[model samples]
Target: MGEPQNPGRERGLDIILASRAYDLGFMSDWGGAGNIISTLYSAKSTNFASTWAKIETKARTELANELALFRGLE
Candidate 1:
C-alpha cells in the first residue's frame, strides 16, 4: 500500500500568504501613525503612499505566482 498523502501540506502556502497579508496590513497602519507624528512635530512627511503602493503591487504579483504554483500542483 502507498503512504497516505497529507492534505494539510497544501495549506502551507495559505498560511504564508495570510501571514504576509497581516504584516502588510500592520505596516500600513504603522505608516499612518508615523505620518501623523511627523505632521504634529512639523517634520517632513515622506510619501508613504507611493511606497506602499509599490509594495502592494509586488505582493499581488507574488500572490498570483503562488496561486499558479498551487494550482499546478493539483
Candidate 2:
C-alpha cells in the first residue's frame, strides 16, 4: 500500500465535531459550557463527536445543495 497514513490526521472527528457542536454546542454555541456549570459537574456535559456528525449531515445535505446552486451561477 501507499505510505502509512498518519495517525494524527483526523477526518471523522470533524463530522463528529459538527454533530456534537450542535449536540454539545461547541465553545461558541449555547455559551461555551462556561455559562452552565454548577458547584458540581456530574459529567463532562459535552459530546463533540455526536455534535460533529449532526452538523456534518446537515451541511452535507442543505449547505451543500445551496453552495452547488450558488456556484453554478458563477
RMSD of 1: 13.1
Q: Estimate each model's TM-score.
A: 0.32, 0.32
| Residue-level lDDT for 17 in candidate 2 | 79
The best candidate by lDDT is 1
Candidate 2: which stretches are off by over 4 Å? Answer: 1-44
lDDT of 1 at 22: 42
Per-residue CA lDDT of model 1 for 1-74, tens digit only, reads 98789888679878977776444333443434323445535645476665556455555666576568779999
> What lDDT is reached at residue 2 by model 2?
93
Q: RMSD, each candidate, Å? A: 13.1, 12.9
Error of 2 at 65 (Å): 0.7
Candidate 2, 28-58: lDDT as tens digits: 3332232234311445557555545545554
